[model samples]
Target: MSTFGKHYRVTTYGESHGRSVGCIVDGCPPGLQLAEQDIQPQMTRRRPGQSALTTPRNEKDKVEIQSGTEFGVTLGSPIALRVLNEDQRPKDYGGGGENIDMFPRPSHADWTYLEKYGVKSSSGGGRSSARETIGRVAAGAIAEKYLKDAYGVEIVAYTNSVGPIELFPSTKEHPSPSTNPAFLDFLNKVTREEVDSFLPVRCPDEKVSQSMSDLIGEFRDREDSIGGTVTCVIRNCPAGLGEPCFDKLEATLGLAMMSLPATKGFEIGSGFGGTRIPGSTHNDAWIKTPAIAPGETKPNVKQPKLTTKTNHSGGIQGGISNGAHIYFNVAFKPPATIGQAQQTTGYDGTEGVLAAKGRHDPCVIPRAVPIVESMAAITVMDALMAQLSREAARDRLQQAGMTNPAMMTATGNGHA
Candidate 1:
């Protein structure tokens, strides 16, 4: 189904070259502080043609709140958002039959999508294109705000690799979770709190960031492309957010990761390498500490109620949040639409060589970070709501003749 979710469903429509692309959020608790600015920064992150490494297709990518809110707040109705395509060059991308269709790029879903659906759109990958992720990212931003304000959840993501230059490289043959700016390891480390800290986020390690940038700059001029991974982490997450069995946390996360374009691989916590480790090494043992402040209060913010010794589970345990650091990695392949020409079959079933037209990101991982974060937020917030609702429902059954449902207050708190 094009739509996803049980309690908090999101039905996204439109296409890359279509008039617009957006999402319709079904479940939202009204009266959360929200504004147009909340979703703007996220759109800017995935916006086409932003940096030298990305495609030059600039589409203002502005957000239009069509429903779900009156002034600037959510009205509990379905939150609908639409982003108009500002800069589009359908002529640049011709495919299938005669001069209309060029050679189909390999590793792209062009043909598979067509084979499965029997029909495709001109320009962009239609729904297959990264352009389709706008609606997801938009919905995610909203979810992020809700979680941040209500439960104080924070999620952050950044580039982790390119070709062989791995930022959060594994340690002792296993992926070690660390909050190193990777790109900015030299100056001050970027954290989840600083939303805009990574602006044009360069490598914290001057030498590394410059070297990577130089490599990208040179390749951009050469019309070549590259690929990498984006690392993301969440802090101060309460335990018991994910549903068991079918609706597991990792299951939901996989849905989001696999949905992005050019994403080759996905991993959470120790991932495959952990398979080699014994249970003693792979298992995460839990401990208790002072209460943590909400997601983004301050360093001195309330003592975190939840704490962990080792985050072997990457903050999630038993298909749910264990209150540790939640982290994962998303793999991306080099942009197939390079300036260099490659041999391929035309849409008409003829052999030909064609250089894929248009501008695109050689490395979508860095920018894809926000998209990933948005999804994580959306999923986590939905899961959180699910947990809270269940708790509320259980309490309702216990209070039978209770007249004041609002007076039910909090269902229950895990610990002091």
Candidate 2:
């Protein structure tokens, strides 16, 4: 059920607190460079110890390419990759005993997980932990490279909100947030302690970040937590990557976002904003202009011609990419784990009080930016591959001189 994609599906298995977690990507074309190093960068980005506002777990999260490659290039087989649970916590809370069933942490999915599976891991949050995302990020990194090399696709994401620290739409609307000098300086220079010291309102929004911090400080003085959203951008997507009827580009993107932990909502392009517009008001008009040199163009040649007076389509339409910039927003809920003590139950399954004794984030949204981008890259790459594979099939048919109507097309239908 973890499978994603019609042709190039990636199924991930294992638990966060399990002995290991891994992913198997079926349908990868052979001969691409596949190595542990290729997947490590993305894993490192998702690693917990990167900042101060995150968990204290100092896991290297090193990856091992177990199959589908020989001497680095893929063997045209399923790619299996994994990371060991090297920093697993002991099952004891030191309160006389570790009654994991009874020592449930507040805001965590422990109760729900137990209800569904009847058992859970005592180490971390078990399967509900963020650690499960490593497999996804790893697979995504590979997909990202393939898409980039094959179709010039680029994927990126930025922190849009951290509790009250939200990004207000620029009156001038620059190309992106991370591109601004002040914003980029803040992100690259501000330490976790600096960011964590603020209230829920001020992480990225100066005013809100400040005000939220004051309120959260009062709450922190009392012990509390918060939530927010992240914005992802995908560019240079090729046209016709996704199919119609089903597997629409936006549909697949939404599925990938929903699959992540703590994601409560999602929106692509003008998402809910289109409701306020009439057809004329919301429609993105097309206007062609003389092509300007886009990137490293030859001195004498202009860039390729493109059109789109507006981006209301979010770069996709009719379930397929229109070869435009694709962007989306993902909403994450407040971290379920909080420091406050609450009334719960014990392993004997009896009523009791619970105080969370482990280290956890008051917010997961800040760190989730990379995860959302990774999933987007993954979905885009898969769709791109499906398009390429179909093209390859058609080419083969052409070589065989199969001119029959059914054999030349990919609709799975034929009639001479």
Candidate 3:
């Protein structure tokens, strides 16, 4: 399970306190221009010590490409990436007066990890640490580059909420952000630059971003933590990118996002709010694609012949993409390794007060933005490659004069 994807496979290695952490990216198409600079920006964003609201652990998170490229072009082979763990502090977890070595941190992977393997790392959460995501971010950067160069796809994620503060709060009239005109408009146009402009919080909304920053500061000062949500959107994805049954596009997306550390919930499109509306109103109705004036279309991008009048289905239908924007929200729980002292049990079944020691964010939503975007890119890239393989096979069949008349008639309109 450490490896993901069918065509674009990524297998990550190393640990939190390990010498280095990284991944091996397999199946990337050859001849695309790539370099360390292309992957460094996202690594910088995901690294710790970004601002006062984040963990104090300082890591440059500098990435190095070990192989699979020559003269800045991929060789269609497995690419290895690595980032040194420069800020490791194993003694903080056990060597000091702290008893974390004896008791598993509450609500953390410490217990389940030991239970599953009957052993654990001397310090830190090992593979469960947020540091493990460095490899994922690096791999995602490669996938994202391919997606952009080949399909003009754009993936963006931002802090949607911190604690109870939200960019678009649900109300009596609008239980879902999908029902809000302003939310829809923002989704249609928000960019990564705009999202990053509001640093420390990354929520885009001026007033709300400031409020969320203050809220995170409050939690940090109290030696506590809070949970929040991240919203992501994938634009310009081609239609027919998902496989039906178990590998549905959204289902895979949910699997990717939920796999991240501390993620507790996942929902797509209208999400849970759609449950409040009736089926008649919740369903997305199809319509002819909107007409664009001459020169309005972006170069190298294709437009779908059909779209939805309402996107309550979230750009996906019947487990396949419909060439509309795909959006979803990922919920992260509060960081378990807080500075507060809690009454808990130890391995010997004894009761005591355990004051945890470590550097952790009071709120993980801000840094989670890039992680969400990266995971989205990986999922979309995998699905896209799968779809492309099928299309290529069908093309060969048609060119060989083996096309079925009934199938041709069924898809005569050329719609995916």
Candidate 4:
């Protein structure tokens, strides 16, 4: 609810050791081409202290855009952005009222955000921090540069697995998923510069990315934290886009990845493993060729019936978009500010033995793969601007019945 797309909305504010975090987007699409060096590479890849397995708290999350652009383009208004919050320790996670701000850190959002807003923020875990997804990877990099400059649309994500060491691609070097190719031809040619050249832990195979970076360095040397799965794909997302039976496009992409911040789970396309097959092998059989792009004729190009040979409905079906290649999966948990030691109870109920501090991330799936490709490019660019406002209101009711013949008998033909 803290705003996300209805039309690429966004919203996000600040909190986790506050002073700055930021967002605001609001229905982008003006003169595109934005700046802040294109939202500082996904806010420096979802910022943290770079790497030693994350969270040493160096936060150089430099973004700024302080207003919908002017010279660098985009004046469709309401952009905002911002970053700051230097290295807000907030005494790690307790300082003000001690007892680690009176307990409650297990599986975070401290006691349901102080029982839904009676007061929370003991620094971090305020907006249920993962630094509140840095305004969703800075408004999903301007809704992925307006869905990759209007519909060449390509959103990639990685990490695929960690807690279980799954990167799938094996002739036996470390492959499993019935032995490689469960999904990956680099997910139809990967790129985010080849997932940052498998840096830190992006996991683009490399023998399961060195066994998922040696199991996140043995759970960051046992201070402990672990959880995984991030897969995303998207390809050229045009077709009918989505929206049916309640804004379905995988239910607004599982409500923009379960409104991120330790997202528990979500799946799409053959998800839940295609319920173990057999709807005649999961029925996606339709085959017509060339909808466009062969003869090079352009009268508002509309060739689009040739996508499925076998997409397992990941490119969405019935719920819309049948262009193909949509894929999904996001699981992320295991980051509730651990440093080990815990017995629980506080805020006056006694008990003791908390032993937590800060500088987290034993494994947040390589910074949650650009926040699941910026919440799937702000939920497929707000379902492709609600299918281009329903094809511009059906081409303005077919151009008002072909240029208003008799203007419907000059507006006096109701029952005359």
Candidate 5:
């Protein structure tokens, strides 16, 4: 199940320390403007050696468009993208020195991978490495472009918490949960550029970002690691973007986030914390409001579609979007490949010392920020495409004079 999405399918290939890592994106709408430049920003963001907080593996991770575009525009064909692995140091993971194959690192996929596949790559955890997320980030850039162009969807993710330090926005800053005007305002206006301007840790708050950086440095110096949370928000996503009965928007998002390496948890809207409040206090009450579209004129009248005064549901309800900001948190565990030595059983079941040798991040939250955004964009864009296809079919039926209630009822009841 490496492939994700129904309408906008993306299948990733290659692995860490492999010749290349890439993905083939199928079902992108035709006639959209696209180019290598459009996809490279995220590539650079997700690449290693960006700063001292991450692994020191120097890889430019330049992406090359292998096919599915002509004259800088998409051809509605499967878009093949590839990035060469020029700095692969397989030996760094004991490919020849100590032979990591003799023992599996704790909290890593080594044992499980061997059990599932009857074999495993001795170097860098193979497909389980965070390097595999490169393909996802690459394809997600394309999805982000299309979503922004079509629906003005803006996705932004930032380090919300690192270890025990959490960046809590002031209650005044976020206001009430029923109508989170401040939070909604921030999500609606924040951009990737704005988020990146925070740099190194990408926490947005300067003081907290510095603290997180210092904490990561401490772990790196100690040859240990820590885990944290990345919070993401999706703005301007049209209402009714989810498919029910299994393909729910939240369910798909949970699946997408969980698929990423080192992810431990996913929560949407109020998430687990919401349970603390009573249902009467937590429910999002509906209110009449006018649609707000830029550069488009509309009469100053209430919209036929109502909106929630509060967004405790996290912009989604009953597995469907409700035209509110969708916000969630992704929890990422620390990198398993630390320099610390630990006593562990070997492949032959003999006890031995395991000191992992490799270039790895002490805290993965900084790098995972972009990965979270990428996964969210891919999921939302796919759901949007599915919704559009259904709506187009309904429009065709209407245009053909087949949308009459009686006719629809008769046809559904098999009275053809």
Candidate 6:
């Protein structure tokens, strides 16, 4: 489906070579300050032509707010946003002597797209293009704004690995970032400004970022592409946000991240590393909440009275948030459209060599950072709204004297 989220629904439209690409953000709460400037930073970060490491497709990706706001305030209606496709080169993928139109690019959506629809775009991957994510990023930015205003939620993502190189490579002694104190410290304090300071690669480590950049350059020079992993953290999230069973927080997060173009895998919290440890070693033990000073306020709204000594659960337990920092990693496969020749079958079932043409990124992890953060924001926002609705309904019932006596007794006995 082109649309996502139960509450905070976002519906995106347009194709890679279309006139424009954008999204409609529905179910936003009213009276929040918003403007084009609010959403442009993320859009700019996601745009191409940022450096030699990325695609040379020059697009400013400037967003225009078409409706659903008045005098900088959201009207609680669907807000439409649009960004024009200024540097379209549809002919590059077809026409002339280029045989790209005949053979489906290996590992691309070309074959499956045609097999599913019985038709395909002659120029690019059509709706499957990375350009389709522009709407997602825009919609995510709006959701992020609301989250930041209401709950002080902060979402940040950065390159964790490019090819075999990693910012914090796992060793036998430290198989996961959860086992490394330094990595935990970095998550606690790392900001978007610090992340962007190491641009082009966005690994946040000076030496590692340079290594990632050099690797991307090597692939670009060879007319090839590479893939990497992006790690994201959502902080100051309130407790009890996720739904149980089918819509568990991590399940929805997996769905959101995997829905992005080229995403190969998604893992949360301790992830795969936790599998190696015993249940006693891997579990997050609970502890008393740290005492606050007389004049100091709580660290954040809805701060839990008790906290976990460890975050092996990634801020979630039993599919519900635990008021801890939530972090996860998303793996993206290498871009399929390369300048190198490959032997493949064509539409007519004939064998041939296909060397694709188009402006494409050698390594997508840098630009993918913002896209990752945006998706996390959208997921959290949707979950938060759903939780808020349920809470309001329960509170109204209690005020109307409809509360169950057993439930009240259980709450009084601290069994809630």
> Could you estimate the TM-score for every candidate?
0.86, 0.80, 0.97, 0.37, 0.92, 0.97
Q: lDDT by residue for model 1 over 253-325, one digit each (tens)?
A: 8777877778878888767666667787666555667543678344322334556665556677778877666
Clashes of each: 23, 12, 0, 3, 1, 0
**Best of the two (1, 4) by TM-score:** 1
Q: Write the per-residue lDDT of candidate 3 for residues 1-416, one digit (tens) a residue.
A: 68989889999998899999999999999998999999999999999999999999999999999999999999999999999999999988897777999888899888898889999887888999999999999999999999999888999999999999988888888777777778888888999999999998999989999999999999999999999999999988888989889999999999999999999999898889988878888877889988777877562467777898888888899999998889999999999889999999898889888878799999999999999999999999999889989989999999999987557664576547
Off by over 4 Å in 2: 92-100, 103-107, 169-223, 289-306, 344-351, 393-416
Please give, for residues 281-326, the per-residue lDDT of candidate 4 as tens digits. Answer: 5677778854557875332225474666666678788789877678
Cα distance off (Å), candidate 2, residue 206: 8.7
Can you give the lDDT of residue 229 in candidate 5? Answer: 92
Ranking by lDDT: 6, 3, 5, 4, 1, 2
Flag regions of model 5 displaced more than 4 Å: 169-185, 291-304, 405-416
lDDT of 5 by residue, 101-197 (tens): 6789999999999999998886887899999999999999999999888777778998988998877543542333334565556665677787788
Please identify model 6 stretches exceeding 4 Å from their true place. Answer: 292-300, 405-416
Cα RMSD to native, each candidate? 5.1, 6.3, 1.8, 18.2, 3.9, 1.8
Sort every candidate by TM-score, greatest first.
Answer: 3, 6, 5, 1, 2, 4
TM-score of predicted model 3? 0.97
Q: lDDT values of the candidates?
A: 0.72, 0.69, 0.91, 0.79, 0.86, 0.92
> Can you tell me which runs of candidate 1 are displaced by over 4 Å?
95-100, 173-189, 192-204, 291-307, 400-416
- Error of model 6, residue 228, in angstroms: 0.7
Model 6 TM-score, all chains together: 0.97
What are the clashing pairs of model 5? 178-310
